[model samples]
Target: MLDTAALKEFLQQQLPANLELLKSMVEINSFTTNKDGVSRLGKMTAEAFAPFGFNADFVPSLHPDYGDHLVMTRKGTGTKVIGLISHLDTVFPPEEEIKNNFQWRVAGDKIYGPGTEDIKGGTTMIHLVLTALQKFAPDVFEEITWVILLNSSEEVMSHDFGKLCIERLGADALAALVFEAGARTGNAFSLVTARKGRAVYRISVEGRAAHAGSHHERGANAIVQLSETIQKVAALTDYSKQLTFNVATVTGGTVINRVPHFATAEGELRTFEREIYNCGIEKLLALSGKGSVCSAEDGHPSEVKIEVTQESPPWPRNNGTDRLFSIFSEVSSELGLRVVREERGGISDGNFICHVMPVLDGLGPNGDNGHCSEQSADGSKEQEYIDVTSIIPKAALNTLAILRLAQSA
Candidate 1:
């Protein structure tokens, strides 16, 4: 068994350090597309890991202008490698007026900021856990091999660097733990078992324009056809299988006096099953249809086109792998925490790692309002955020115990 008292002391010491690091990181403003900020954060991360005797390296993405991905590893005696993944990017865009708004406010126990709850807090937790392991259980680190993966982009469908990180780390990992924000209720530590797959698409319609005052009957309206297609696609929702299609954006019409010549609709679909996703796409494509009317004098006819793009693969649930869960639950129980399992419609880097190894996610401080300015740490009656942080050492202890068990297995 791990030494609970020593672990607690180690966590207490590391929490303040993590807080300081997080504040610095937040000040840097590593937005998804900001190459300079991302590269800066990567260098800072490499410097931080150097003191632990780990070799840190940055793998630049295919796009030379974007921020590079980071992979930090400490090789040990075992062949079984476990990975902890987190992202440095925030969803906020650079062009937005509030781009540099990293100012944080403390309302009682709740900390409010842009990236605090979504992931910066989680990143701090990950650093704290590793630092505690390095301090209290140095021998455990020697027994097991592990890596820390920090991606530069995850907000914009992971774009390029996220996928590249998966290709680099997937083959060698025995298991992965994602450090995303925890559940709404602070008392429950959720082991995310499943995530929905996503696909983005754009549908375009073309029709002949005509004078609204005279030749209206000779023209075909593209906007009307596109509207019908949107409704047809929205009808593909299957709640039982957790498949859904949302029509996020639509644009058409130049003026009220003329029939619109073009129209475009953009949307995404999420599903838990692969076949369901395929079927939904087929249904979406079948909705494209040209209108009946056309301008004879101009020799222009109505047309419809559909384009589909695969953004990210769905992360299916692991029905058979209970070893990691058993260990996590055992450790959390030992630390006096209640463990729970959850399924979400969202996607994370864990989706890629889970394909090769057992993965658990949402293991950070509890918070809500993920993508809004009103985002605040969940400080309900339970005081879950602080409680979760207080048990950081115990979670780190659990992680070490699991790593030791995997090394032997």
Candidate 2:
């Protein structure tokens, strides 16, 4: 019974203002470690969310340097609760933003900035959609409980604190929506019902060092041992199971003349199936033998250590998740929008919340070019961007989706 026309009209009317707000947000470098900047953005967001009947409260994280977590709630009359999850942090450091001359640029349909696509746009749209609903569709808005968790350090999922916020806020909720940006292409929205879990680890190898000319053969060659280990680890990835292993970083050999005494590799594991995911984790941990056969020349064992640095469980699909997607997809068809049900290889805070309750993700702007802080292979400064045209419609879609879910519940 919600008025779709009025919702779309309200969004269209406020598009320019919302874009301006996005520009302001993207300009502030809220890198995970930039605690002060994240807090400032959080405060500004709380102020912006106030007019929509949301009571904003700041929850301190386990550490002060990671910035404070934000939870905003709007009371309603219904029994069911719907949660909106988003993050304020970007991958770009403050220095990188300035070095790359990161600024919101309007070019045809694209809005170019550092955090525009990664999720700053998503955060902006969340506030805009709710504000529009309160003005044009109060009945639907006031019918169900609303819990908005604006977290910091999602790029890092830092210390499980972001997950902690979701656990705290959505413990009583029926469903949740994550405002992460959509696909790597096109403007049609994608509803993510499932995501791959990830585990990051640092592997180190220690070996005997010796001079290259005097006693090169005496050294165990840590770099060589690490190379073999990286290959074995990479081979563990199975495409059919949607499991992938990547060695993201490697460090070894300080100088050309000497066999290095220490070498290390940092890598990640991503998979969708929990059992398969756990098996891989166990295997990875087992690779950390105190002494492993690292070299075949002399059959000498080397000390290899693998320590998990971070982890996030996969967001598996369930009956409730399927039902939520059906509701959202129906609303999308009604709005003349094409929405594809997607299972993502990348994990988000949704993965954490899905453990407790079903969740819908990727309800943000659509564009590619995210997760960039490095130059392209061609050496041009790679920029992150999002489709400006996608914003209003996505905001509209999210607004209608929430209202319909709330009203029906």
Span of ten consecutive residues with least summed lDDT in model 2: 290-299
Q: What is the lDDT of residue 243 in candidate 1?
A: 88
| lDDT, candidate 1, at 320 | 28
Error of 2 at 388 (Å): 2.1
In model 1, what are the clashing residue pairs, if there are any? Answer: 197-314
Give me the displacement of residue 62 in model 2, in angstroms. 2.1
Q: Rate residue 15 of model 1 by lDDT.
A: 67
User: Can you write out model 2's per-residue Cα lDDT over 241-337, one digit (the tens) per residue?
Assistant: 8888999999998899997878999989999889989999888888776555333346556788898988888887787788788887888888888
Query: CA RMSD for every model?
Result: 3.7, 2.9
Give the alpha carbon lDDT tens digit for every residue of 92-132 in model 1: 55554164343555556566565677677777777777776
Q: Which stretches of candidate 1 lie over 4 Å from their true place?
A: 93-102, 170-172, 184-186, 289-301, 319-322, 374-401, 404-408
Model 1 deviation from the true structure expressed as Cα RMSD, one decimal place = 3.7
How much is 224 displaced in model 2, in angstroms? 2.4
**lDDT value for model 2:** 0.81
Can you list the residue pairs that collide in candidate 2? none
Q: Candidate 2 at 295: error in angstroms?
A: 9.4
**TM-score of every candidate:** 0.88, 0.90
Question: CA lDDT, every prediction?
Answer: 0.70, 0.81
